[model samples]
Target: MSKKKNKVRPLPQTVGINVPGVETHAHLDMEDFKEDLPEVMARAKECGIAKIGNVFLGPQAYETNRSLFDAYPEVFFLLGVHPNDADQYTDADTQAMRNAFKSDSRLKALGEIGLDFYWDRVPADVQEKVFRTQLELADELDVPVVIHSRDAHEKTLEVLEDYGWSGKPLLWHCFGSDVATAKRILDNGWYLSIPGPVTYKKNEEAQEAVKFIPAERMVFETDCPFLTPEPWRGKRNEPAYVAFTAAKVAELKGMDVNELWAICAKNAYDFFGL
Candidate 1:
């Protein structure tokens, strides 16, 4: 008997219309969109993506993707060193990030920084140290922070608490935790950035989280080139696809999609001070 062949599904050539929304976290600096970045931005505008938070993984990413600010005025930046790259972080990189945020009006937040036990590319201690340093820097600068926690929710929360993060502008980006985790984040007065996973049929936890998280404390994101929502699960995600996630979240919240869109858009503007 012949073995069953496992065929890889192809991504869609294009996705649907952009409903008015804000993508709170995306890595547009990555090489995924180099060939069609202009087209992607055009589609994002057409789809009603009013603003996009382009997160930088490191200083080099900031330099490489800085042109995006000029190319798309709607694009803003979040500078930070991702936990996976924690080993390469340096004082000079930290200084440059501080300088960039100080000088650039468009640099909105210090973000996508936190623990990721899922991939032990960097040791936990080192990641924790880097995370703490950035958190302290954010506290000193009085700027909002965007955090990325994967399989480290408990530790992430503990650290946030230790840092005295209470009622400040903090966002748990690409929130993939349970309702309990959502409640903890809310209790801290921090915001949650919902991503494409909420649209997945099997993501009951995310759906539940959406139901419980108040619309005012909720925002949508694509985390593009990753976590593509339903109907486009196999595709390369983008800022334009944020609308799909928003629609899913709206469904879960038992509200009209347009109303949810307006709410999330306003929430994003308020959170980022855009």
Candidate 2:
């Protein structure tokens, strides 16, 4: 047989311990995984990812792609209209999401929502309106809210504070901000999900924030097909790559990589009720 030409990369399992870990955010149903999704899942399993939270951009994606993970009960979901698509948010979509949450037990949190000021795709007013509407939906359903804040952290904080989300089941996703912002989120009694960007050498702010953030309040995510951590930084990110993030986080906190992996996994389980 002719030798395959694929380059041999380091296995994430080499960096990760055999203990069960959780990937808090991923978009497995996206086109990036379309060609090798099964291989992706197997790699994730080999690296000790016992569970994964697949974030669907909107209710339509959820309804259309929910079946992708039917055989993999280890994969749960996070559904919401992203701030970038605020203009498309409508009542029918809200109702569909409500119905899915009620009927589908795998649906965990209403999230990856909030604001994205870095992108000027949607008008600010419309984004705010859709965000509040989804917030109301999560509150009414008594489910947790997962936030996606970019350069709009201040305004996002103001909205959440005014809505009385302090001490509520809120998670600040992709937390790449400074220590002060992290402290603010912690003060509100919310959990923070650090993403792969934390591994970059230039991200001193994220490093500092992750260093002191209490173990109990900290969790991890890959946000695959987006932010890939170092050692595999320029490649297409998959769930298994979260091990690199765990290693970086553990290094920053002066803890063992395997131990930190398990701790963050447990925190993810608790926060998402997995």
Candidate 3:
């Protein structure tokens, strides 16, 4: 027999604790996972994610989120109309969200909501209108807000300045801006969530932003099914891969992976009030 064919691999041995993790933002309701959600959640648990903050982005995402929470209890839900979905927000949609807020404390935050002037499929005016409406709803409901801003940082900050957060908890998810923009968010007492793109070779802007932000205010995410980190960049990402993002963050912040992991988990717990 050839040496390659005769190779004996050792049996997999029991490993000690992997880094306890949290995927701060993900779309578990996305169509990609529709058929295999149980397997996906099982993988996440096996990889040591203590919680997943699922983004409710579709007409059905809220119901999907509710069902996940009911079924898994460990999964957390945050509701929002996505920027691309600005055209879909009607009085009925907003009311559905409000009713969910009234009915479930499992609904922890209002978001993945903000301006996306990048595509402008919806007019800037429409995006602003929907964003302001959601922010108002968040303030009225007294829940934190998770913001998704892309190529509209000034507009986003301007809207926040104009309407004023009025002491509501705020989070800027998938933060891809410069150090200045990161500083503005940090200065306003909002949290900044970094994602897998931080590990990309050409993502210097993201890396610079991560370097400047204070570790205490920083959080991590996969933004999965998108922004998959290196070595797995082209594959469909799941919460199980969040450690790669965290490892990248640790490299940037010059801390041990476990230290950063625990710090981020603590920040998430404090931010989401879990």
Candidate 4:
């Protein structure tokens, strides 16, 4: 008697309109793409990404954002020193960010900004100073802000509250924090941007947190070239794979993927004013 063989099949490829999406945050100038940005961006365009929100860290990246804007119309710019690079912000750097934010309507938000105690590359005080200053700058410009919070949620919230973010649009990017934290952020009426990692197995925290975010206040992102979802984890992420992230959100929210797509797309469009 011959034994029957079992066949394994690959996951179905994602298909749908690559409607223009606004990546809430990504570091395209991270030196990881120093050699092949053209190919990277080509794939991004092919994937239906209409715009990329690139965050600049210091003086060099600050300038790079301006240059990139002139070079690639599809790429949008945000100016702020990242938490890890907090020490790099000088009076000149802050002035540069302010000037860029003031002069260009294209500069949408002050971002990639917030607390990150995980690496502790800079002193907590320095991070707080830079974060607060940028927040003030964003407030002055009447522009929304994108925040990068990790391990220092309490302090981050405290600072934002102290700064009085009562009527501003705040984006919490790549949100993988706890439900309680999500509730706090939501209570403040800020938007939580979900990324691909929500699809990962055992990512209960992210899944739980996403449940409380209403569709209108939630946005989708790939944070591309990083945080690629399951079945594609460990590989470089791209804009096209954001469908996987949206699919995961749909599953978590108990809604149809199409509905989730529409809701997320609207939220993104409004958030970026695109």
- How many pairs collide in each candidate, listed in order? 1, 0, 0, 0
lDDT of 2: 0.91
lDDT scores of the candidates, listed in order: 0.86, 0.91, 0.83, 0.78
Clashing pairs in 4: none
What's the true lDDT of residue 75 in model 1? 88
- Residue 214's C-alpha lDDT in candidate 3? 80
lDDT of 4 by residue, 44-141 (tens): 66655677777776557777545654778887777777899888777887777777777777777778799999998999999999899888878777
Off by over 4 Å in 1: 1-19
**Top-scoring candidate (TM-score):** 2
Order candidates by TM-score, high to low. Answer: 2, 1, 3, 4
Tens digits of per-residue lDDT, candidate 3, 1-274, equal 6456644422111112266667899888788787888888887877668899988894467875457556887788889899999988898888888999889887889998999988888999999999999988888898899999999999999999789873558989999889999888887888999888898989999898898988888888888788887757777888877777777778888987778878888889999998
Per-candidate TM vs. native?
0.92, 0.96, 0.91, 0.88
Ten contiguous residues minimizing lDDT sum, candidate 1: 9-18
The per-prediction CA RMSD against the true structure, in angstroms, equals 3.3, 3.0, 4.1, 3.9
Q: What's model 3's lDDT at 10?
A: 20
For model 3, what is the alpha-carbon lDDT of residue 42?
A: 85
Higher-lDDT candidate of 2 and 4:
2
